[model samples]
Target: MQHLLLVAATILTSDPVPEDEDVVAGWPGFVIFIGLILAVAVLGYFLTKQLKRTEANRKAGVFGPVDDEEPRDPEEPRS
Candidate 1:
């Protein structure tokens, strides 16, 4: 219909201006962003430390026998 076409054309041509032109992420947003970055950094540091300790423990055979040794049978008595 002609009325529908006219309405569509008007809608397409119209550019609605915003009430506040200077919209921005303020100080609170900046602070939260900084906090997230710091949290990730701290978590990464702790994770690295724990991973190093675990690697050291593994090399020292804390978990069990070394990889080169054959696994012992459960039914066999220890010497």
Candidate 2:
């Protein structure tokens, strides 16, 4: 257990430091992230609207009345 703990500690503490240029490039990097968030929000809004319409239609039975058709073999006698 001591050996495993030492290996885990070393791995946890070791991290690469970012360079000066990487640290300074903030807004440009964030622009793409912000754009992705907006796109996802727009898509979610449209999907919600479509689902609401479908649910309303389902409640109203807009597709038409349900048929009472039954499946039967060709050789079976009809009532």
Candidate 3:
């Protein structure tokens, strides 16, 4: 049993592909290409949505300035 297992393991681990063989050919390649394009498009859509939301928040003063009080002269002492 041990010898059988050893032989089987050696055969399974050996390199299966020959130099002449082409990888990712035909229909499989087309499917992968389309999947990659769709992934990028979906990512871009969400990114654009987030950026627009942030811009809207900024314009609406969701992020307040450092000084809420009116701008004072530099020489004026802080109360």
Candidate 4:
């Protein structure tokens, strides 16, 4: 068993370890394409929802700024 283990270790140590650059170069385009698809999807979703809300608000009449009571005197220093 010890001899077998020694032979395996020697084989493994003699082989060159794989490098990151080779792995990264193989998949760079796939990563960038996925990122672009994700970004377009998110932006489209938000813009669609915003447009829908604006249309609904326009129909509801209570769309603009609020007009409640009077403004307090700013002269009083806040604690």
TM-score of each: 0.57, 0.48, 0.52, 0.45
Query: What is the lDDT of every predicted structure here?
Result: 0.87, 0.82, 0.84, 0.80
List clash counts for every candidate, in order.
0, 0, 0, 0
Predicted candidate 3 versus true structure: per-residue lDDT over 1-79, tens digit per residue = 9999999999988958756556547898899999999999999999999999998887778886444456888898766
Q: What is the lDDT of residue 1 in candidate 2?
A: 100
Q: Which stretches of candidate 2 lie over 4 Å from their true place?
A: 1-25, 64-79
Q: Which candidate number maximizes lDDT?
A: 1
Window of ten residues with lowest summed lDDT in model 1: 15-24
Candidate 4 C-alpha lDDT tens digits along 1-79: 9999999999999999788775554467889889999999999999999999987786666666432355656896544
Q: Model 2, 37: alpha-carbon shift in Å? A: 0.7
Q: How would you order the candidates by TM-score, starting with the best?
A: 1, 3, 2, 4
Query: Model 3, stretches more than 4 Å misplaced?
Result: 1-16, 66-79
Which runs of model 1 end up more than 4 angstroms from their true locations? 1-20, 68-79
Off by over 4 Å in 4: 1-25, 63-79
The TM-score of candidate 4 is 0.45
